[model samples]
Target: MKIGLVCPYSLGTPGGVQNHVRDLAEALLARGHQVSVLAPVDDNEAPPYVVSAGHAVGVPYNGSVARVTFGPRTAARVRSWLADGAFDVVHVHEPMTPSASIIALWAGDGPFVATFHTWQVRSRAMSAAAGLLRPALEKLDARIAVSENARSMMVQHIGGEAVVIPNGLYTKRFAGRIRPDWQGSDGTISFLGRMDEPRKGLGVLLSAVPRLVAERPGLKVLVAGTGQADDVRRSLPSSCRDNVLFLGEIDDAARADMLTGSDVYVAPHLGGESFGIVLLEAMAAGAPVLASDLAAFRQVLDGGRLGELFEPGNATALADQALRLLGSIDERDKLRATGLSAVLRYDWDALIDEILAVYDLVAR
Candidate 1:
């Protein structure tokens, strides 16, 4: 079977949707199914079937960018790709985006599926556009969401329930590809995601770092991912500033190094995460994680038994958890072991089989 993936984000974005597509594409290829990606090209050398989706434009509702629409040009390319029967199913990732969704809506006659990946948090105005796009989503042979929370939100707004197809991780993709600049040492707490705004709890991580460092003095924090990294870098207090290393937007390899080297992965995320794909990635890399106790995060963290859970946006609790992990070796190992084992529940093979089952059900 040949599969076509249409994602609004690029390969280099390092977000859940893009990473999901990357893993799913390769997983499909490994199964002898031809997979193609339609997205922005960040790196010149990409998977064989990828077509450039142009640079992204920032969406008003979400911090992330939606791919630029080339009007009929994009439509033509999409139609040509779909019309060729080169794909048995067209899997559209993040179908609400204006540009990418339009391309998917206008594409071809094959069985098409849309995976909704966002909360649509920007504003009320974007709903008009979202409303305009509902038919296309309705037209999908099947629809999916990364988490139950995501599926509920999509149903409430779009008037339909999409099957919950959790994202999968390609655990060994970064084997032996540690970052050159990464120097793994004792007592390092890591934050790996977009470093913008207070929502992601970068501020909480920054606030917690100083308190943790003051207690242990050996505690260092590694902040990974790209957006607004400068804000995080600048806001770091003088004492703990040097101790906090900023790894601005990394590839799979760098994320692997950070996860493998760090004592604990911290994501105090307050909003916009449905499944928290990064949490699973960290777990797969054998890093103990400290995350918010949101329902979606709980699903990813295995109901908090697999890792430390704290209130979202709480700096003090976050600090306490960080300090605890920094000092303990046995608990850290336990969290790591538990996390890796838990991720086996969401492996690509199992996930794809479930997804295919949905396709069969929906397409019928």
Candidate 2:
């Protein structure tokens, strides 16, 4: 089968949707299917199968800055790509965003399937654009949502239902050898996301740091992502500043190694999380997970049975849970064992068949 996948976000940037599209294309190619991905890219060189739609510009969206591409030039490019590829099925991710995915929906004339990956309580942009978006959306042969939250967004804003299909991960890639240097020594907590973004909740984690350091003087916090390290460091109390290490931005291998060495992986996100792919990655890397009690996080953690959860944005609660997990070896081990078992269901091998079934249904 020949497949074409469209990603609204820039491939050069690290994002959930971009990673999903890349991994899905690779999984399909490995299964003897022809796959091509169309996305906006920045300076980084993309994989051979990726067709660059052009550069992207950042726009404020969903509590963060989203880099996306649109306009007449991009639309023309999408039409050309669609015509030249002659794909059996085209899958567009986050089609509601004003990016390449929505442009592909409007320009292409073939079997179209869209996957919604965002979950917001309300979207004024979507509400205002409903009439304009509906005509193009009607061309879709099928619609998929990455989670129940995302499905609800579609029903509320677009007045349609979508089949729920959770995001896929390359579990084996993260389950590889651990780097000794990246491993935590005394007591270590790992966090990965945009440090500058408030939704990523670096501030909440910083607020809890003083308590954690007081309890275990040797506690080390490994902060990895794009942000001003100095700004983050200054936010913490001077006494606890030495306990935190900010790793500006790390690649995938380093991320896995960091998780492997961590005593606990903490995701204290405030909101705007549709699905927690990082949680799955941490679990696959044999790290015990502790996160906020968002609905999406709860589903990913299996109601806290696979991992641990605390009240969102509560510094005291986060600190208490972190200390509890850090102090109890048996608890962390139990979480590691359970998480490893549960994460397999989200592996690409388990999910590819379902995605292909959707494509086959649409292409027929």
Instruction: Please give the RMSD to the true structure for each candidate, in Å.
Output: 2.8, 1.2
Q: How well does model 2 score by local distance difference test?
A: 0.90
Cα lDDT of all candidates, in order?
A: 0.74, 0.90
> How many pairs of residues collide in model 1?
1
True-structure RMSD for candidate 2: 1.2
lDDT by residue (tens digit), candidate 1, 1-364: 6677887776655567777888888777887777778886666777777787665555544654443454666677677666664677788877766666557765556578888877644456656766877766667888888888888777767776677888887666523334435543447678876666456778777777777878877566788776766666777777877788887877667778788877788988887677888788788888888998878888877788888899988899988877787788999999988988888888886787887776566442
Candidate that scores best on TM-score: 2
Candidate 2 lDDT tens digits, 70-173: 99889888999999999999999998889999899888886999999999887677787766899988998999999999898888888878898899898888
In model 2, the worst 10-residue window by lDDT is: 176-185
Clashing residue pair totals per candidate (backbone < 3 A): 1, 0
Clashing pairs in 1: 61-122
